[model samples]
Target: MAGARVTTGSRLGVRIREVPVPADLDAPDAWLLRGQVDTVNEVEIALRGNRDMCRNPHETLGSMREQRYTTKIRLVAVDEDRPGDAADPARVLGHAALHLPRQDNTHTGEVDLGVRPAARRRGIGSALHDAALEVARVHGRTMLTTTTQQTSEPTDGPLALAPSTGSGRLHRDDPGVRFALTRGWSLEQVSRYSVLDVPLPADVLAAHRAAAQAVAGPDVRVVLWESRCPDEWVDQFALLQTRMSTDVPHGGIARHADVWDAARVRTIEQQFLDQGLGYLVAAAEHVPTRTLVAFTALAATPVTDEFVFQNDTLVMREHRGRRLGMLVKTANLQRLAAERPAVQRVGTWNAEENAHMLAINVALGFRPAGGTGEWQRDL
Candidate 1:
């Protein structure tokens, strides 16, 4: 639904337009859309210099289309084609996307913006952001959220194994940080990124698994599922999903609680399928009640075999005494090894203050990889 009208910078011939994906999205448009990620990745590489990164626009767009969360995407393009431009004439210079979640976090909208390295400081980012903020306002969102990364700081201890920013590399300051602060965004939360190298030493994996197994005891059972939850466990699984909003530590950030039902759970599961990404889930069950007491998930995209994303590990409070968290996590690690053997490592994020979860991750050999600042601004 791209119209002839432009949103900004007519004098510079930079046009900002919506890239709508109708139900019947065609190959040509999809290819064009995916190129934007490539441009963004190029910029990321220049900034990050290859610290394990992967982005699949196919999954991003498809997931957005299927999820209950609505999204508005705006792309800035130059009318004149440039040499080596993947998208000619309407060469995508940058883009911004606003995500509005339906279940909860209704008062908040997440915003992500990226500008090509060569296109920075040309007002494309600001223009796209302006348009995105307008869209958020139209949807009645009161707060805008975004994340920015700083180069990993030097550290000793287990985190020392993580990659460094190279000598003389600036650590604290970044253009994104300045951009957000200048626009009135306030830092809300800091989450540390970590990665676990795959194929942990036989002794290490065995020791951790044995220790967790001993704590889990005979009354607890582990369950494994791919992509979809079974009908019988759907309700319990949904409850656990809802609990994550309150259970997980969010630091000082104002996180909205979520309400999840079986149908909504299935909708999210289906959205992963629509994105063509692989999903692996592991849950622990209480033997007597046959109830799912804890769960964790890992997602892998076809774009890269080098890394997989570890997401959402949650254990119910009543089930906390046992090592259910460790059990389910180790169980999923075993699954990830068998199913996605090509994956070389797994990356995860944890709030800086979540000592319990961080301890579990450290026990599993996940070392600090980087850090990101979660910023928020009142609309």
Candidate 2:
């Protein structure tokens, strides 16, 4: 993970240096981690306001560390500073991260950047973006991508307009989106982040389950598991994961189906277990073929049971149009409520153009909380 340093002296006198490890949650490194987290938090709050969409990563740092992913963090500072420099306090004006995949999807690299609210237009973000781009190039990545929360009408009419003078006021009007567009990045897709307030009426849950059961017919059975997938069904789960990439609507983003095997599935399952995270998996199995046709999962951290993230939900192409998607999602939500009673809300993301999946989510009482734009540049 060694690379030449990327530094830029400009509008506000800032430098970008790589942060190799951002795992330590206490003391010295904790301060550095806070600087990085605070800047991103400030930006999110400014854009999303009091919405539940704003993310606070102060406690999730350790859990994010995974052996299978390569992530480099770069801090934009005022003084002559580097990672782990004990002499001077790092005046982190902004920060950026370059994420590269180790196991698969090696051709694409992700760039995450943020600037403090007080230091918005001083070229700090530019420096960090340039540094991340160079690092991606050095790592032999051809595609650079990022996602941003934007405040605008989530409609095709406004989205179709290119970045130009006097355009509507969107979060895109911010420095981050302008910087990406000026640097040759294209808007690939738009996605909506939906939130579902939990503990719906008893009747609602019973009705959803009844509807799913009726749609599933007698041939399809619902299955639930916690944490790890059973050994016998590992291959079936991997196949479904591989199909998710192509089956899900990605809009214009160029992404190949992920290469997943039994080993990869096990690796991920173990990761969640090690992090003390609770997982709920619900799948719809076709009794006649004795195969899993649809599946959904929810990830909840034991440290805080206030919220759970909807991981993934997929139904095989041949098995669609039978309400399996809703069935699996509802079944998993029921399992989460029963097993992890502390969860108050669940969050999920879907491409704006994915009407089918969106319809299912709306049916289950999920509402749009915010929107995200997927930006990309091909090198």
Best by TM-score: 1
lDDT of 1 at 140: 89
Question: All candidates' TM-scores?
Answer: 0.87, 0.85
What's model 1's lDDT at 134?
76
The 10 consecutive residues of candidate 1 with the worst lDDT sum are 161-170
- What is candidate 2's lDDT per residue for 1-379, written digit by digit as tens? 2333434444455556555345565545555565666666677678766423343343346435655644444444433444565533346678786677775678997888888778766667776777788778888899988976655443444434332222222354555567777899887777778889996666787788889789789999998889889887889999999999878876667777777888888877876766576788999999998899999998775545678889888999999999998888888877777777777889888777778889999998998776666778897
| Model 1: per-residue Cα lDDT over 257-343, one tens digit each | 887899888888888888887789999888888889899999887677777889899988777867788888888888787777888
For model 2, where is the 10-residue window of minimal lDDT? Answer: 161-170
**Cα-lDDT of candidate 1:** 0.74
